[model samples]
Target: MPIRFTQSCPTCGRRVQIRASLIGYTVACQHCNAEFVAEASIDDGSGTTDSPIGVEKIAVDPLMARVEEALQRAAKERTAVN
Candidate 1:
């Protein structure tokens, strides 16, 4: 079976499964037809290059998260004050 990897289409924000063979090649989103380069998923500790790609878990930055929360509170406060 051909290995596949799922990545979100940047234009339409839909998950797209790309053939493993097409990695590093240009491919279009099946749903939106947006063209983009195919990227393999982050390694899952298997250390294998041919592993199937799936949803990647992105690590959240604590400082960035705090900043985002602060910004959101500021926005809400500004709206209330106005």
Candidate 2:
């Protein structure tokens, strides 16, 4: 069975449909260029409880991580010198 979920763009609040099978896959928002992943859960028949089917954690881009590290190092060195 195919699962579906909605995700709101962090930048523009645009709603986007995501397939549960695509969980853990990175996708770019067409409206805002923001990247996100899909997560889903199954609703219990009682309609009062839900179970997490899976989580799609967003992966931090390596290039962005490296740049952030460099910036932190530079800031530390500057502070040490001052």
Candidate 3:
């Protein structure tokens, strides 16, 4: 059996399982069609690479965003009143 390691898709945050042989090779995400490299280190599992991963898109809840904005507005108003 081939060894496999797990990583998240930079675009869609989907879980990806890569074969050990494919390390240092370029790969495309099946979920979002985003391209990235199958990078890994043999010494440790820190998952660090010289190249940085790009985030194409991220999903967020509208309600959470509204709540965050409201909190920011409230803080600004409070500061102005003080």
Q: Whose lDDT is greatest here? A: 1
Best by TM-score: 1
The digit string of per-residue lDDT tens for model 3 on 1-82 reads 5456556777888878777557668888878889888754332447543343221111135665565578779999999999
Global lDDT of each model? 0.70, 0.62, 0.62
Per-residue error for 64 in candidate 1, Å, reads 40
Which is superior by TM-score, 2 or 3? 3
Off by over 4 Å in 2: 41-82
For model 1, residues 1-52, the per-residue Cα lDDT tens digits are 4456677788998889877668778999989899998877665558533443
Checking candidate 2 for backbone clashes, the offending pairs are: none
Model 1 vs. true fold: TM = 0.51
Error of 3 at 12 (Å): 1.1
Q: Give one digit per residue, the lDDT tens place, for model 2 in 9-76.
A: 66787877776557768877778888876544454557432454543222235665575578779999
Candidates ranked, most accurate by TM-score first: 1, 3, 2
